[model samples]
Target chain A: MDSVNPSSKYKDTLSLIIFIVVVLTAPLWGKFIGAGYPDLLQKFAIFGLFAIGYNILFGLTGYLSFGHAVFLGIGSYTAAWSFKLLTMNPVPAVIFAVLLSGIFAAAIGYVSLKRTGIYFAILTLAFAQMGYNLAYSVLTPITNGETGLRVLRDDPRVLDNALGVQIDGSPVGNFFGIEMTGYSGYYFCAIMLILGFYLAMRVFRSPFGMKLIAIKSNQTRMEYTGYNPRPYLLAAFVISGMYAGLAGALMVIVDPLAGAERMQWTASGEVVLMTILGGVGTLIGPLIGAVVIKYFENIFSAINESGLHATFSFLPEWLENIAVTIVSPFVGDGWHMTLGVLFMIVIIFMPGGIMEAIRRLTAWVKRMRG
Target chain B: MEDNYVLEISGVNKTFGGLKALSDINLKVKQGTTHAIIGPNGAGKSTLLNTCIAKLVPDSGSIMFAGQDLTDGMTPHGINQLGVSRVFQTPEIFPELSLLNNVMIPALAKRDGAFKFDLFKWLRNENQLQDEAMHYLDDLGLADSSDIRAGSLSRGDKRRLEMAMCLIQHPKLLLLDEPTAGMARHDTNRTIELLKKIKEGGMTKIIIEHDMHVVFSLADHISVLAQGAIIAEGKPDDIKGHPKVREAYLGTAEL
Candidate 1:
C-alpha cells in the first residue's frame, strides 16, 4: 500500500527545519546560481505562498478550483487602493488583501461547492471569469481596467501623516519606517513565507486537515458517518484564498502596481500546475514547484539564440546549428512549451510529481545501504 | 416494547418519478434487537434504510428515531448525529487513507460532529482518539492491517474495516444494507458472528439481506417484503413458516 507521508514522528519536525533552512538562506544559495536578485526571490516566496495555500484545497481536499486568481487579483487591487488612499506601509496592504480575499473565497466557495467533480471546477472557473470581467470593465472606477490601479504622489496617506511621517520624499512601501526595496523586500516576503509555511503545516496535521483529506477520499462515507463536508471544504478554500491574497499583496509591496490581467484564468491555472509539479499532498512540493516554474519563466525565457550559440561554441557548425534549432523552440519565446512538456512527463511518469520521485530515490538509496 | 422501539416508521410512501419505490411502509424496530429485512431485489429494502438516514425523502409519512424526526429536510449527517449510522452495500471506507484513519474518522466524528478546528493539534501517532480507533480495529479483527491502505485490502477485509468504521461511532441504531452481500460462506459466517457479538452489547441493528441463512442466524425479528411492500412481519421462526413470505420471496428456487 502506498503511504501518504513519512510514518516517523520526527518527520514533521525534520521537514520544518529543512524548510526554514532553505527559505532563510535562499538568497545566498540563489546568489551562487546567479538568480539572487531580490525581485526574483520575492516573486519566488510570494508565489510559493500562493501555491501552498492552494494545496490545502486542491491537494488535501481534492477540490480543483479554477478561480483562485479572483482572490489574488483582489488582494493586489486592495493593496494598490490602500497605498492610494491610506498609507504606503506594506502591513495594511497584506492584512487587507488577506481579509478581503478570504471573504471573497467564502462567498464564491459556498456557491461553487454546491456541485462536485468537473461541475465544481466549472463553477469556480465561471466565477473567476466573472470577477476578471468585472475588474476589466464594470468596476473600472476601482480597478482602473487595463490601465490598472497605482499609487499616486502627494496623496493623503492618512495614517502615515498622522504619525508625522512626511510625504516630501519619494513614495515607497515601508516596513515600520524601513524602506521596502531590494534585500529588505525579499526578506519580508520570505518572512511571510515562513509564517505561511507554519500555518499550512499546522493545518495539514490538524484534524481539520484530516477531514479535508477524508472528504477527498470518500465523501459519501463521511456523510453517513455524521460528518458535514461542506463547511470544512469552505474553510480550506477561504484559508487558501488568504494565501493567494498575501501573495498578491506582497507583489504590490515589492513592485507597487495592480493589473486587471492578474485575475485571468491562466494565472489561476499556473498555481494549479505548480502544486501538481511539486507534489500535491506533501508540505514542501508546492513551493518547490512555484520556484522552479518561476525560474523557468524568468531565466529560461531570457536565453536567446546568441546565448545558446555562445554556450555551444565548441561544437561543429552543423552540430551547433542542429542543437540550437532543436532547443530554441523550447526556450526564449517558447518557455511555455518546455513547461508543458515537463508537466506531461511528470503526469505520465511520476503522477505524485517530483517529490514522489525524490522519495523513491531516497528509499532506493536506503535499500542499497541496508 | 412498542414504546422502546429504537426506530419507528409510520405510513411512509416514496416514489421515483412515477415508479413507486416504497409504499405504505410501517416498521417498528425494537431496542437491543437485531431486525433483519429480507426482500427481493428492488423490493425497496435499500430505500427503506435510506429513509431511516434521510438519504431519500418519503413522499409522505415520518421516520422517527429515538422520538426525533429523521425525515423531511434533515441531511444524512444530521440523522447520523442523532445516533444512527449506516454501512453501504459495498464498503465505503476511505480508500486512500490507512485503515487506522478509516476507523479513526468515524470515532472522531462521533466525538466531534461535522466540523472541528483542531488546527495545531497533533492528530496522529497514538493519541487518545487513535487509541479509540485502534480499539475498534482490534475488535473487528483488523488490527494487523491498521497501517495498510484501506483500498489495498481484500474485499472481505474492506467490509470488516467498513464495519469497524461504522461501529466506532457507537451509534444507538445501526443500519446495514446487505451486510454480507457477495461474500464467501466463511466471510458471511464471520460477519454474522460479528453482528451477533454487537447485538449482545445491547445495540439495535436493522439489517437488509437476501440471504436466509444470515437472516435466520442473526435476526431476532424479521420483516419480509415483495414489490416494495411488507408481506410478513414476525419473529424469525414465524417468518420461516409463512406461506406468503416463502411463495413471494424465498421460493424453492433459492431454497
Candidate 2:
C-alpha cells in the first residue's frame, strides 16, 4: 500500500468541511448574486456532481472521453422508466440509473479504451453520437423520441401502487411522501453533490488515484512499473459514468424528464469544458467549472438589452446605447461567446483553471506575508 | 526445469521487414550476477532487452526466465510481476509526480499486484510502505528532494530516480538499457558505485551500456555483440581482450 503524510489527512478533512458548508449555504449566498432560485440551485448541484465524476477519468487518467453524456442520458432514461414502471420514489430510480449507466459505460469504455490519445477521444465521441441517434430515432419507444421519457398519470407505478401511496394529480418524485421539488429537490441534489465530492476527494488521495496520475504523467513508465493501465482506465471510466448517471437521475428527480438532447455531443462537450474550466486534475475544480458554466447559461443568458442599459444608465445616453450594443452579443443567447472568451483567457493565462488561479493567489499572499 | 540460470534466451530471432534485429541470439544469465551486453548503436542490445521484457515480440525462439517462458505470450506487466523490471535509456520516471511517488508507485504495483480498488483507503496510513520508499530515496541520495517533482530533476538525477524506482521492486532480473546514457564522468562513476552496492544484494542485473568504464566496473560477465549476433562472451577481462569485440565495437579506439 502507498501512504501520504498525516498532515494532508487533516487538510482533507478541513477542506471537506469547508466544501460542505459552502454547498449547503448556496441559497443564502446565491441571493446576493440573483441566483437564489431553487431550479438554478438544483442545476448547480446536479452539474457539479457530473463534473466531479468527469474529473476522475479526464483529470486523473488523462483519458479525454467525449461520450460521457450517453451515460447521463442513460441515467435519465433509466430513472424515468423506474418512475413510470416501478415507483414514483427517487431511490430506486437513482439506483437503476447508476447501475444501467455503469453497464453502458463499461461496454463503451471497453471498446473506446482500446485506442489512446485522439483516437480514444474520437471513439468515445462516436459511441455517444450513435447513442444519441438511437435514443432519438430507433430507440424512441423506450426513450420516447423527441417527446422525452417522463412519468405519466396513467402509467402503472407498481411499487407506489403496492405501497398505497396516494397520487391525486400528476406524479412527482417523492422520497417517502416528501415531494422532490423546490428547496427539497435542491437539498437532495446538494447532499448527493457533497457525497460525490467526498468520493472524488477519496479517489484523489487514494493510491489508485496516484496510479491514475502516474498513467497520465507517463503511461509507458506505468506499464514498465508492472501496472496494467487498461483496468485502471476502465474503472475510472465506469465510476465517472456512474456519476453522470447519478446527475441524470437527479435531473428527473427534480423535474422528471429524460430527453435525447441530454445525450447529445454538445452535452458531452459541456462536461469537458466544465472540467477544464475548473482545473483538469484538481479536486473541486470540476464543480467550480460546472457551476460557472451553468451560472452563465442560466443567469447571464437571461440578461437582456434593458438590463445592460440599466447597468450603464450612469453613462451618457449615446454611450450607454453603444455599451449595451458592444456587450449585448456576450449575454442572453450569446452567453456562449462570453464563455468562449473566458475559456480562451483561462486556457492562455491560467491553464490550470480557476482553481489554479486561486492557488497562485494564495501562494502570492503567503509570499507577501513572509 | 530449474537451473542456476536466472534467465535463459535461446535461438531468439526478431526481424523488421528484411532486416534481422536479433538472429539466433543465445545467452544465459546466471543467478546473482551482473551481466553486461556491450555493443555499438543498433547492435540489438536494447532489442534483446525489450524482448526479455515483452516490449517487442521475437519472430522466433524462446526466452525462459526461471522456468517461465517469456516468449509464450507474457505481457510486460506480467513479466514485471514475475520479478522482471527494466530501466530505459531516457529514464522513464513519472515526470509530474514527486520523486517519492515515483519510487512508491512501483513498490505499490509490486505489492498490490496488477490491480486493486483500495479507493477509500488513506495513503497516509500505509506507514510501512512510505518508510520503505523513504529508505530507497535515502539510498539514492535523494531523500532531501523526495518531495520535488521528478520532471524538475536534472538528467543524472532522473537516472538515479529511475534506478530507485526499479530497485524498490527488488526485481530478480533487472534489465537496464544504457543506465548511464547521458551523464558526466562523476555521475557515471556514482551510478557504477550504486550498481556495485546493489550487486552486494545478490540481485541479478543485465546492464546494456555504451560506456566501457561502467560495463567493466560492474559486469562480472560480459557479452560483446556486433551485427545482432554475439561475437564473444566470457569474463570481463577476456571480453576486453577479444579481437572481434575490439575491431567491431572499439574500432581501433583503445579501451
lDDT of each: 0.88, 0.91
Residue A317 lDDT, candidate 2, scale 0-100 = 98
lDDT of 1 by residue, A236-259 (tens): 989999999999999889888899
> Model 2, residue B12: displacement in angstroms?
1.6
How far does residue A225 in candidate 1 sit from its true spot (Å)? 0.8
Per-chain TM-score of chain A in candidate 2 equals 0.95
The DockQ for candidate 2, computed on C-alphas, is: 0.76
Best by lDDT: 2
lDDT of 2 by residue, B122-231 (tens): 77778898899999998888999988889999988898899999999999989998888887887788888889989999999999988888888899999988889998
Model 2 TM-score relative to the real fold: 0.96
What is the model-wide C-alpha lDDT for candidate 2? Answer: 0.91
Enumerate the candidates' DockQ scores in order: 0.74, 0.76
What tens-digit string does per-residue lDDT give for candidate 1 at B108-192? Answer: 8889877787677767643787888888888777898788788999887888888898898888999888878777888888888
Cα miss at A135, model 2 (Å)? 1.2
Instruction: Provide TM-scores for the models.
Output: 0.95, 0.96
Clashing pairs in 1: none
Best candidate, TM-score-wise? 2
When summed lDDT is taken over every stretch of 10 residues in candidate 1 chain B, the lowest stretch is B117-126
